[model samples]
Target: MALREQLDADMKTALREKDSLKLSTVRMIKSAMKYKETEPGAAGPLDDAGILQVITSEIKKRRDSVTEYEKAGRSDLADKEKAEIAVLQHYLPEQLTAAELEKAVADAIAEAGAEGPRDMGKVMKVLTPRIQGRADGKVAADLVKQKLAT
Candidate 1:
């Protein structure tokens, strides 16, 4: 089923099961998807990749907020953001392990013939699609840097 439909079904199930966290998280995702649908030039309904991108962006935003809140000594706010992140992550694909990410970066570097950091753009071009929805861009970039430096 389409992600949006699946999310809607899950939302209903969550309501019936009294899963407050999942319900809220799913509703937030649904709202973001709806907003994207209404945006200009969005084309038809978003594909799985597009939905994953939206979910990833939402998680990234929450993570960033958690960092900022913690830096400001607002532990309560940070905790709330972290909780939301945990809930949202339940829908994401299993993340790549460090070792697996290293392998992926090495492969991408080899495929792109990236000899040095100057070829980061080329490496990123080859790596982004491979890692998309499976890992964070920052994490992937770090792995790519580590692979290229050696």
Candidate 2:
């Protein structure tokens, strides 16, 4: 099934199961998707890839919140954000393993013929699409930087 359909089904299941956390997170995702759909130049309803982008963005936001909450010594709020992250993560593609990400970064570097750090953009241009929704951009960029530094 498509992601939209899956979300609908899961939403219904959450409602039935009285899973407040999941229901709220799913609603949040749908809200974000609706907002994206209405954005200027939005092509229309999102495809799976587009929906994945939205889901990924939501997860990132939660992660940032978790960090901020932790810094404020609000363990309760941080735990909430972490739970939301867990809910949001279910919809994303399985994350790339460290070795897999390293290999992919190396492959991108070679494919782009990136000779040094100056060519980071070139490597990332080749890499981003391949890793999108499966790997964190910061992690991938850091790996690229590490590989390029040597």
Candidate 3:
């Protein structure tokens, strides 16, 4: 099934099960997708890839919130953010292992003939589409920098 259908099914399931956290998170995802659809120049309703992008963005935001909440010694809030992360993560493609990501970076570097940091853009251009929601962009960029620096 497509992601949108899956989301719909999950939304129904959440409602039936009375899973408030899950229901809220699914609603939030739907809201984000709707916002994206209505954004200026949006190309109509989001496809699975676009939905995944939104889900990934939501996960990233929660991760940042978790960090801030932790810093303020708000364990409760941090835990809630973490739970939300878990809920959002359920929709993501299987994440790349660190080794897999490193290999992918190496492959992209070679494919792009990226000799140094200056070629970061080229490498990323080739890399980003491959990793997409499967890997974190920041971590991938850092790996690229580290590999290129050596």
Candidate 4:
């Protein structure tokens, strides 16, 4: 099934099971999808790739909020954000490990013939699509910079 369909099904399941966290996360994703559809110039319903991007962005936002909450000594709010992040993460593709990400960066560098940090853009242009939804852009960029600097 498509990601959106699966999400809808899961939303029903969450309601049946009384899973508030899952239900809330699914509803949030649906809201984002709906917002995208209603946006000016949105041509059609989002594809799986677009849905994945939206989900990943939501997860990232939660993580960042969690960090900020923790830094402000608000453990209660941080814990809530962490829980939501964990629930949202279930819909994302399996994340690449640091080692796996490093290898991907190396391969991308070689594929793009990236020579120095100056070629970071070229490497990123080649790598983004391959790693999308599987890895965080900041993490990938850091790895790419590390590889190119070596």
TM-score versus the correct structure, for each prediction: 0.91, 0.98, 0.98, 0.94
TM-score ranking, best first: 3, 2, 4, 1
Candidate 2 per-residue lDDT, tens place, 1-150, comes to 999999999999999999999999999999999999999999999999999999999988999999999999999999999999998889988999999999999999999999999999999999999999999999999999999999
Stronger candidate by TM-score (3 vs 4): 3
Task: Please identify model 1 stretches exceeding 4 Å from their true place.
Answer: none
Candidate 4 or 2, higher lDDT:
2
Number of the top lDDT candidate: 3
All-Cα superposition RMSD per candidate: 1.5, 0.7, 0.6, 1.2
lDDT of 2 at 124: 97
Candidate 1 C-alpha lDDT tens digits along 82-136: 9889887777789999888888888888899999989999999999998888999
- The alpha-carbon deviation from the true structure for residue 65 of candidate 4, after best TM-score superposition, in angstroms, is 0.5
**How much is 13 displaced in model 4, in angstroms?**
0.9
Which candidate wins on TM-score?
3
The C-alpha lDDT values of all candidates are 0.88, 0.95, 0.97, 0.90
Screening candidate 3 with a backbone cut-off below 3 angstroms (N, C-alpha, C), the clashing residue pairs are: none
Could you give candidate 4's per-residue lDDT for residues 16-89 as a string of tens digits?
Answer: 99999889889999999889888999978999999998888898899999999999999999998888888887
